[model samples]
Target: MVRGKTQMRRIENETSRQVTFSKRRSGLLKKAFELSVLCDAEVGVVVFSSRGKLSEFSSSSMQRSIERYKSYAKEKNLKHRGAEDNIQLQLCKQEAASVAKEIQLLETSKRKLLGESLETCSTDELQGLEVQLERSLTNIRLWKKHMLTEQIAQLKAREKMLLEENAALDRQWKEECLQHSAVSEEAAHDDRTSQHTEVETDLHIGLLGRGRTQCLLQA
Candidate 1:
């Protein structure tokens, strides 16, 4: 008898859905194991249930397999990158040339502002360069002021942190010193008590001997 095709839809009944998931998951894992054993192929599988429970299988070390896969992908990418190497080199060269040209223009403008190369400049161009140079100097001064302000703020924050750390260390040292002083006092008290006890015992013995000698003389 030909079995009817199962429709590809979610089972609305909760129990039926759960049962179907369990059966399918077991079959999938069994097939994976069979493939690994029969074909001697490295196989890994991971499945998550609707409840976020995980099931995993690996024929060999999963970590080794993942690293091997990454290596293969990296090797493929390296080979593909070879084709673009020349294009990247050309772009880098073009960028370098652009930067060099800009530097040369800036150097010429600087020389003109420093009273050199002014022989070729017209009166209008010289006035324009003077105004441009003043604006640039003003911008530089503003930038320098901003940078100094930022540095001062950073230094103040660092100084505050250092002060707080120093205060904590000083407090800790004071506490340790107090503890040590208390311990020393306690030890000194013990020693003084012991010395007093020894002196009392010796005096008592000496009085007892003197009393015995007086009794012998009176007799």
Candidate 2:
């Protein structure tokens, strides 16, 4: 009968657990020693038991091996970071070149639009430029016409406002003139009444004085 594969798990019994730990630690140390001797490699192994006991193997001093591993890992990380930085630098250069090319194309097109560099243009290009210019002119004229319409509407509105204001001012001036005329007439009537009263009193006094003189002459 074929033996079934055993599942690996923690040994529950304390004695069995200790025995397994001892066996595994020794086997790991032996492997590290063999690897160092046979392949001339720097090998290190470390293990800790549940009770905080330590087991370690190193081709050289443990401290030296740990320091070497740290330095090697640090150097490898620096090399990887430098490679990423180089890739980023290359990408930036490509993007800058693309932007520069786009700017150059835009400048060339601008010059063409301004009629500054037409000597190198082909017949088809000139025709296209002419069509573009005509379309632009049409759009400009339409915009100008629309602006003028708006301006005319605004001016008409302003004229209507001014006319309304003038009408209001004229009506106010007419009303003020009517009030002034009425006041003047009232003042003139008062003056006339006062003069008439003074004249009547003077006439009555003259008549009475004459009667008194006649009565004295009779006496």
Candidate 3:
């Protein structure tokens, strides 16, 4: 029969737990010792009991082994970080080179657009450039026509508004002139009535004086 795998878990019985700890601790320390001797490598093991009792084994002095492990771990971590930084730097350089090449292509295209440096262009390239230019010119003309249409519509609206405002101002001016003319006619009528009343009063006084003088002469 095939042996079953042991299901590892906590031993609930206190006595069993202590027995397991004793056996495992001895086995681990023996393995560590054997590994150190057989491979001529530094090895260390540390164990703590539930009551905080310590057990340790080392191929060399425990303190020296711990210090060496710390130093090696720190050096390995630094090397890993440095390698990552180098990879990132290489990626950045590659991206920069790609961008530079793209910029060069754009500059060459721009020079072609401006009709500069055409001697090296093949006939097919020149024909393609001509087609591109024609397309660009067509697009530009369409855009300009659209813009002018919008401008003309705006100007027309503005002119209509101005004409409406001018008509309103003219109506207001005509109303004011009519009011001024009516006021002038009323004032002139008042002046004429006053002058007629003064003339009639003077004539009446003159007639009375002439009658008085004739009566005195007759007397």
For TM-score, the strongest prediction is 3
What's the distance in Å from true for residue 173, model 2? 0.6
TM-scores of the candidates are 0.49, 0.64, 0.68
Q: How would you encode candidate 3's per-residue C-alpha lDDT over 157-212 as one tens digit per residue?
A: 99999999999999999999999999999999999999999999999999999999
- Whole-model lDDT values for every prediction: 0.94, 0.95, 0.97
Which ranges in model 3 have alpha carbons more than 4 Å from their true place? 1-77, 207-219
Compared with the true structure, what per-residue lDDT tens digits does model 1 show for residues 80-197?
A: 8976897898999999999999999999988998889888899999999889899989999999999999999999999999999999999999999999999999999999999999
Model 1 pairs whose backbones collide: none
TM-score of 2: 0.64
Task: Give me the candidate number with maximum lDDT.
Answer: 3
Model 1 poorest 10 in a row by lDDT:
78-87
Q: By lDDT, is 1 or 2 better? A: 2
Clashes of each: 0, 0, 0
With a 3 Å backbone cut-off (N, CA, C), the pairs that clash in candidate 3 are: none
How should the candidates be ordered by TM-score, best one leading?
A: 3, 2, 1
Angstrom error at residue 172, model 3: 1.8
